[model samples]
Target: MSTLTKSNHIGRKISRIRELKDMKQEALAQALGLSQQSISNIENSETIDDERLIDIAKVLGVSVEALKNFSEDSVINYFNNFYDESAKGQILNNSCSNLTFNPLDKLIEAYEENKKLYERLVQAEKDKVEFLEKILKDK
Candidate 1:
């Protein structure tokens, strides 16, 4: 049987790293201030610019060199070494409870954004009211 050789694909590396970190496309998109469709397009791309690559590395919590030199073997070895108990025939209970980023942090960020937006909207309304009141007084 013939074996399939993979190309040196940077997109695949980013995708794999993202998956290993248990991050969804939407989360990565949010962190990068990009759309989920943009993330998907990036993953489907074979190459990325250096500056953007740096941003992606920062978001993924890895160095640019690490992304360039990413390999399945290295990742597998890392995991194998991480869970030493797994070598002893113990089943690993990998659960969703083990999230890379804190949910509370995201919630707080959302709350702060919403608060700022609401404040802006309220101020705009107040300005409109004040302008109308001045017009009525003039009339």
Candidate 2:
């Protein structure tokens, strides 16, 4: 393939993988410690540095070679060649449909719990300050 074609292919593959992972470009940028613009440039097939490519691959949990050379057939072939029936069964068993609660719902619940705990901590700190002031006044 031409360099431009390869670059575009890589960009599309990255975009697809990012979507499958349910990540935005900004989120992927944050994970890779890169700017959103850099991610945008990458998705546009602009030149990217080798280190950044490695970082992207790491973030996407794939090899740099895979990122560079992936085609739809290769992906399908990979699943066909590497995935066993037992592994497929395990994947299904651990799939999102088997989950009791949506992951986002769990995250929101945890966030609310953390917010309430922080508020209680702040109130306790204020009460402690008031108690200390009263003790000093009585000294």
Candidate 3:
């Protein structure tokens, strides 16, 4: 397949999976550390990089290969299961008819928290390495 066609195929699959999960583009963008426009571009088959594809796969809890090669029927089937499970989880979590928070909202909050934690951890590791280097230099 041509590169554009391949990218379009992947984009369509990503879009389908995101919709299946009842996730907004903004939420996916946050999970992927990308802008909403970037997600839009990918969905519209504009341009996307391999790193972005990997990130999308990671956020969607799917394999990169699966995201890249998912057939339409398979995607639809997966979406049905995904929606059913999410609905069940929601019902279990909230006994009342009213929901205090939307699932996507909670997901975005969790993703943002995780992203911040990761950044902090990375900074701490870098600082530790720098400190070790300085101590060695002093010795």
Candidate 4:
């Protein structure tokens, strides 16, 4: 099924998440008490053990479900709706003097983070396609 396919690329998802977090293989290795080569192999592996995946996700500051369900389009859609509703609230409550904290700054930070992730996701997809094409050509 399409749903299964979308959630199946565990290694790719981990690599993308690491890149989006601005982490290097060496950094993740350090966090997990692994060598850089081990981290590299993990990222290249098609399947990883559940416990190892959980540890890696913790080092990456994400949940296993997030890694499994990650899709750039879904992230973009979530932020779009979130910011739209946020803007509407601000517009409707422009005169509300009771609001103590400003959330726009945090929202902007999240948006920038998402933008970086989107760019990395696009590059990763391109790299995957090129890798597949290379294998096909070699065969």
Question: Highest lDDT, which number?
Answer: 1
1-139 in candidate 3: lDDT tens per residue? 6646744466778888888768999999877777999888898874458888888887887788877777776757876987898988753334344655588887898998999889999999999999999999999
Pairs that collide in candidate 4 are none
Clashing pairs in 3: none
lDDT of 4: 0.84
Q: What's the distance in Å from true for residue 55, model 3? A: 0.8
Query: Model 1: per-residue lDDT, tens digit, 62-109?
Result: 899999999898988978776887878887777666767787997899
Encode model 2's per-residue lDDT on 1-139: one tens digit a residue: 6656554456777877787778999989867667999788788774457887888988886788878776767767766755675665653344555655577996897698679879999999999999999999999
Residue 133 miss distance in model 1 (angstroms): 17
Which TM-score value belongs to model 4? 0.55
After superposition, candidate 2 runs with Cα above 4 Å error: 1-8, 78-139
TM-score of 2: 0.49
Worst 10 residues of 3 by lDDT: 90-99
Alpha-carbon runs more than 4 Å astray in model 1 = 1-5, 85-139
Error of 2 at 48 (Å): 2.4
Collision count of model 3: 0
| Candidate 3 residue runs with Cα over 4 Å from true position | 1-8, 76-139
User: Candidates' lDDT values, in order?
Assistant: 0.90, 0.77, 0.80, 0.84
TM-score of every prediction relative to native: 0.61, 0.49, 0.50, 0.55
Backbone-clash count (model 2): 0
